[model samples]
Target: MGAVTRLFELAAGADRLGLAVTRIGLVVVLVWIGGLKVYHYEADGIAPFVANSPVMSFFYADPANYKAHMNPEGAVVPANRAWHEMNRTYPFALGLGSVIVLYGLLIALHPVLPQAATVGSFLVAVMSVVTLSFLVTTPECWVPDRGGPEHGFPLLSGAGRLVVKDAIMAGAALVTMADSAKAFLRRRARRTPAEVPSAGAVAA
Candidate 1:
């Protein structure tokens, strides 16, 4: 019985630690990717996804001309400059990067301002779902070649593989949101006299 009790306690401890680690992992990913979006190469790489997205296509000034400027090799060209300037790419990227960074910072502030963290987690969840949708909406997600490596349905191109990883982020965001929400509720409950059980109820 003692050994069993000890083992259960250890498992509980590990579960608590796992939640912290998950939050940290998500923060790292959001901050890193968000930071990269500020760069021209990363912004160019994502042009296809944004250009094809019905929800986001308006962000580009010339969505029709996106292909003419984007190089599959990720090279910077004269066309790239014109496309970026005309499309307002830099300002858009900077805005997105700022939002992402704020989310990470808010998550890290969980101990001090849990309400903010809860909001951040919710935002992360929403963003993750949008990103994962790219797998279906973006044609570049799957391998184009007929006989190429991992071609077709179950297989993804390099860009597709990257987008697919958003599934994990979505899951993580949900977990973080649940945790933060529970904490917030608990704190609220503590402050509410109505939530406290009477002595008779406790005895019962």
Candidate 2:
């Protein structure tokens, strides 16, 4: 084959490997972030998000009172700790982390359980949607209105930047889901007969 032809051939055939790498990236992100959710600091950091979420505010004991009892990362305040305990922040973080780890493991087992991996991929996409919604629901995502010209809808804060990354995660999950679904269909095709007897053939 010509050198150019060979290059094209290699690129064309690398789709599977590319997806495998994407799967690895997804697993690493899910597991690493999920594991972090178990820490007190991590739970405290998410307080603003959960407190502001329309769907998730119920997770806090008093979402309206969250700001007054906020704990800065790594800071130990007895009153804030007690409030968080009452709010179930630590317990919720642990549970969320466990689910994330489980999702990563499911994706990792694709070689043996593509079905589970497909489900996990779907969940990942759904979760990413929820994460992205924070940009709309959480005020912390936008620069605060501190009398600065750079504080408004188009101005994203650090939390906003982080939430925006979920769009990429959602896309990756969809690509993996599509690949898994194709594999499932191919397997099903193999299990069925190669051909069914036609009505004309039976009549003949």
Candidate 3:
């Protein structure tokens, strides 16, 4: 069969549409989280959601300042109290957020849809790992006060729901990755014998 025909055949059978749908969904999630980060930086409303607790305080404090330091240029800025807090606990959020945005745009616009999805899936897998780790470490909600008369203990609570959600997100990412990988390998397999030249030809 012709190369173009074979290429189409290889790509035609896999769940490309499903992959695209999930990829777009993943992008939406990324964009949401990215916006959250931006809000934490720019708006003060996010403070209450994460205020006065050791676990989530940094989330409320100067979010923009926090995000600013995460950029490549922001790397050199001396670490202060806010940067130290968020960077220490949720260190991957900034880089992962930026990557997600880029991946989303590429998948949405790239001419090579298959390749974009494949690469985007891999990046989403990385994000899933980070999300899973956060789910493991932090509780969803803590007592607003550190040392109230009711119970002075540094209570950690509500981690279960967040964990479940994050687990779902991670699973979605894994499925997306698997679908993309299958598409890639199927395309590779459809290559003609001449396309898979000997090692000598590859070297030459």
Candidate 4:
């Protein structure tokens, strides 16, 4: 029983390091995935999600027409590629990727710049919220009925499974934000001067 309690204490002691590692892990995910968006296949892969999003559709020249030009992963359909070029799909993806990478880098400075990490973690949380909405707004998140009884609600397609994992990131972002905010306050407090009680207050 004493040894078990010691193990629990050890885990508690490592919590701060765990949070720091988690921040780095999230940075790795954002940088790698965001960097991939600059590639043809990666940009093409995200079209369905972007086109289906009402909030994002404005970036495309003709969001409604995207379905007809849908290309599978690594597919090199000239016609579809041309259509995407017209829609500025690649450009939009590149810009979004830059923003994602920037956020990751901002969070990476958590140790010395808690203020930046707070802002970055907040942005990540907002981004995750938008991503999670894809499950509702994007039909492709669920398996389409091709005469299969296992299609639709409660049945996640591969994309849906991937999007759902953003929930963890969202939660982690909040945790990181809170930690950074607390750290910022601690720094501020250290720099602040202590208040001295007036004589009347001291007498009370």
Best by TM-score: 4
In model 2, what is the error at residue 107, expressed in angstroms? 1.5
CA lDDT, every prediction?
A: 0.84, 0.89, 0.53, 0.92
Q: Over the stretch 1-204, how does candidate 3's per-residue lDDT look in tens digits?
A: 699999987788666676667667877876776655533232222232333334555544353343334423223334543453544323433544566577666544433465676677667666556545543343333333546554212444454334346566667667776666676677767874555688998899
- Per-residue C-alpha lDDT of model 1 across residues 90-191, encoded as one tens digit per residue: 777878888898898888777777788888988998998998888888888988877756677777888899998888888888898889888888888898
lDDT of 3 at 175: 76
Best by lDDT: 4
Give the runs in model 3 whose Cα sits over 4 Å from its true position.
1-20, 41-96, 106-113, 139-160, 191-204
Ranking the candidates on lDDT from highest down gives 4, 2, 1, 3
Looking at candidate 1, the ten consecutive residues that score lowest on lDDT are 67-76
Per-model TM-score on C-alpha atoms: 0.84, 0.88, 0.48, 0.93
Q: Which ten residues in a row have the lowest lDDT in candidate 4?
A: 66-75
lDDT score, residue 122, model 3? 68
> Which pairs of residues collide in model 2?
none
Candidate order (TM-score)? 4, 2, 1, 3
Per-model tally of clashing residue pairs: 0, 0, 3, 0
lDDT of 2: 0.89
**Model 2 off-target regions past 4 Å?**
1-13, 193-203
Each model's Cα RMSD: 4.5, 2.7, 12.0, 2.1
Tell me the tens digit of each residue's lDDT in model 4 across 163-192. Answer: 999999999999999999999999999999
